[model samples]
Target: MVVTFDVSPEKEGSVLNYFYRQLTQTPAEVRGIDLGGKTAIVTGSNVGIGLECSRQLLDLGLSKLVLAVRNVSKGQAAATELSKDINLNPGTIEVWELDYASYDSICSFVERTKGLERLDIVILNAGIMATEARINPSTGHEETIQINYLSTALLAILLLPVVKSKRPLAEQPGRITITSSDTAAWAKLDERNEEPLLSSFDKPGKVDMLNRTFVSKLLGQLFLVELAKRVPSSVAVINMATPMMVYDSEINRETARSLMGKIVEVFRRRIGYTAAVGARMVVDAAVKHGEETHGQYLGLQKLKPMAPIVYSSEGDHLRSVLWRETLEEFSFAGVEDILNEVNSDRKEIL
Candidate 1:
């Protein structure tokens, strides 16, 4: 399995700039903001950056906050813990179950969103860092790819309509932000030329464990490139906000027991930003700025392109390939019809 990053001039330069910002830039904080009437939902809110993002939203006076987790009981537990830190009005925060690993769970969560009266911001922060490749029993895709890319795409597609219709039509459009990473620039993506690209990702032997999350994040950026073309910023603003590399965020919980994880943790505490500080970027993406940032990458809270390769002719070909295969993968759920409806509803965007 491939374990090392593909070294190149592009990767070297990008990584260097990223590290410089990480070392020199001051951590971001969302201030002078108020969400008194807005409602927001965050996945993976039980711990790490998600939890702190939820906290910041509530502190800003978000009327309703939903912590969508895989386990309702644990989500409730998290909600309780959140309540103790700050005063929470009755029903201010709600716990909803959403498991990214299961297609049914994601679909059901979307269905539940129909009951909400308002949805101003959605931060899709739930993802895993895998140290090895494994297949999801419910969905046949590799675990990391399934959770971070495919299922995230499915949920984002389904939620776009809900966000569009329920938006309060404030000064700006509703936002759907995904937590992306700088590591995406390092993926080799040898599978780009495969006829059935997703299947190639499913082969455990074909994927390197270390690069799995990076591959998933890159796939997400590729999907977004195609998505923005079909669904315009007017319909709903969507973008990727990467915090670069955050330590003490516990996003790598999957590898917590491994020797590599321990070493990474030591350095993370020494060099990486705290989860609270890292989450400000996620909330910043959701609340600050407007249409200019739509369908773009917010690297360390700055507008940036996805990857050097995403602009190449080869990247263009791969984008079309990924779109076709991704839709086919979810055809059983009428995903194509869902996207077509989104496109048709936003015909004014054209």
Candidate 2:
């Protein structure tokens, strides 16, 4: 029933708040947590925060860990490296390919989830922040929109039924934690004035590469707000875990591959948590929370506010539009169809 945080959008979108959070960042308190029989899937696991999260999950006695990555070979290599660090039982960890850039890949990955007997945790760590306003050939949306918002929305909606179906009648609702950013609060979202908001995102020239990632996360919060309403916490626990600013995360260096990137990396290393520390946030999000976490935001080692605008009148309009457009976009993937066949208890289309 909670529509948004009590703070007004304008009041919450302050740089000082973010700086204070950065100055106070601490490691998430999730180490030694019991996860004996849990099965987990972490996207973008080959490198950066996802790899470290995969390591921490296994370290915590997670029984089955799927390192869902864009590259199978890299995932295998990461798995091998992790084996060197931990006493991995045979088949304790697996590497599955999941490329968020492609809709086919996302759908194929969902199809493969039917094989899982039980899925206790799903941390959607795959994302990108494009410095260029490049349009995806397949989806025709900006890269940030395609990967960060649209594809993620598609995958999460489709995965809800699968995540819930894997649980026993008495088991706790499965965790679906998606990474979000505090920067999301900073987005002015000038495009909100556009009558058909999503279309403005699809137009190449309209996207401001510098602000698109923040915009995408803002858009994502709106999507999550709507999604949580349709599917209750009992059906599937959903939330966003923000790592603040992890300097070594994959998305961090993705755009800064040059000398500027190296320079920025140094600054990032100095200020932001290492990938390992950041992974603690991701791990905490998946295993250490419950129904209260459903449709909420967790950051700085605890529950926090969502994007500044996420619950405003504007946020409501934007979320509704995002839900409508995104639902239509993924309609071809049969998200409704999948739920209709696998889960009947949930009345919503999802």
Candidate 3:
């Protein structure tokens, strides 16, 4: 039976909790061996799902890992925490500074890693769910859109060349995995809201929780479809649908302090899966082979096709527009220069 949980009275509010409860009841299977000598860059991995994902990969024996985080201190702490469980070689976890809100930071991240001997994996796991007033910073874009979607797109492009250049050792090509959400099912990608998603944050009072979740979820799916076209056979782009209310690092004690937090906390505790379990889906997608599974959305530890609406012509148009707009915003031409420049300063960057 397809189990579902009624964690919250409201549809939007229940997502995170419902997902956690359902996934735990029926977790997915994982298969893989050693990943020694392989390299992966995971953004916003200082905590939460990103941290768990990194832990899993490290335990698999990754030779080197680039942990892209906005806070150097937090990154160091997370790396230290992860090292306790896994055999982390000295300097195996390299911390790189990256702010998804700033194109400059994204450019700098790609440029710095250009000289890497080989890059086998890139996980676009950073995201934001801010309901504060709208502020674009110097990036000239909405905060959520900038951090969640734009920065990710730029990262992919910057890394694409690198993934393409490296020869797959033992015939296993490099991989790029993105963490998405089920909210995509209701996303209105083609239809521009009277107010952009960021507008809600500008007027905190006007913010609607459900709307933000749904919009972010849809953008993720659109990104996946568009990104698939650019990745080569040796490179795979996989999107993981994270359990909404998992009681992992993603929903910590901080979420239980306020009324909303208390509600979220109750739901998660009663129905959600743990962080480690949720991470298995992401890990599997990154390592799983077989063309039939490529370029697909996955959920509940299996290949669940995207909603039909996701394929509507509107999704197509948005995909094209978003792709072009993102490329222009980040200045695609600067990627190679950025990578080359960063590599030249390798001694200090590390």
Choose the strongest candidate by lDDT: 1
lDDT of 2 at 52: 84
Candidate 1, 33-77: lDDT as tens digits: 889988999999998889989999998989899999988998999
Go through the candidates in order and give the clash count of each: 0, 0, 9
lDDT, ranked from best to worst: 1, 2, 3
lDDT per residue (tens digit) for residues 130-192 in model 3:
644355767655566666766776777677667756646556656777887666665544335
Whole-model lDDT for model 1 versus the true structure? 0.83
For each of the candidates, the C-alpha root-mean-square deviation to the true structure, in angstroms, is 4.6, 2.7, 7.5
Model 3 gets an lDDT of: 0.65
Q: Which of the predicted structures, 1 or 3, would earn the higher lDDT when compared with the native?
A: 1
Using all chains and alpha carbons, the TM-scores for the candidates as numbered come to 0.93, 0.92, 0.80
Cα TM-score of candidate 3: 0.80
Clash pairs for candidate 1: none
lDDT of each: 0.83, 0.81, 0.65
Sliding window of 10 residues with minimal summed lDDT for model 3: 1-10
Runs of candidate 3 exceeding 4 Å displacement: 1-24, 188-205, 251-258, 332-350
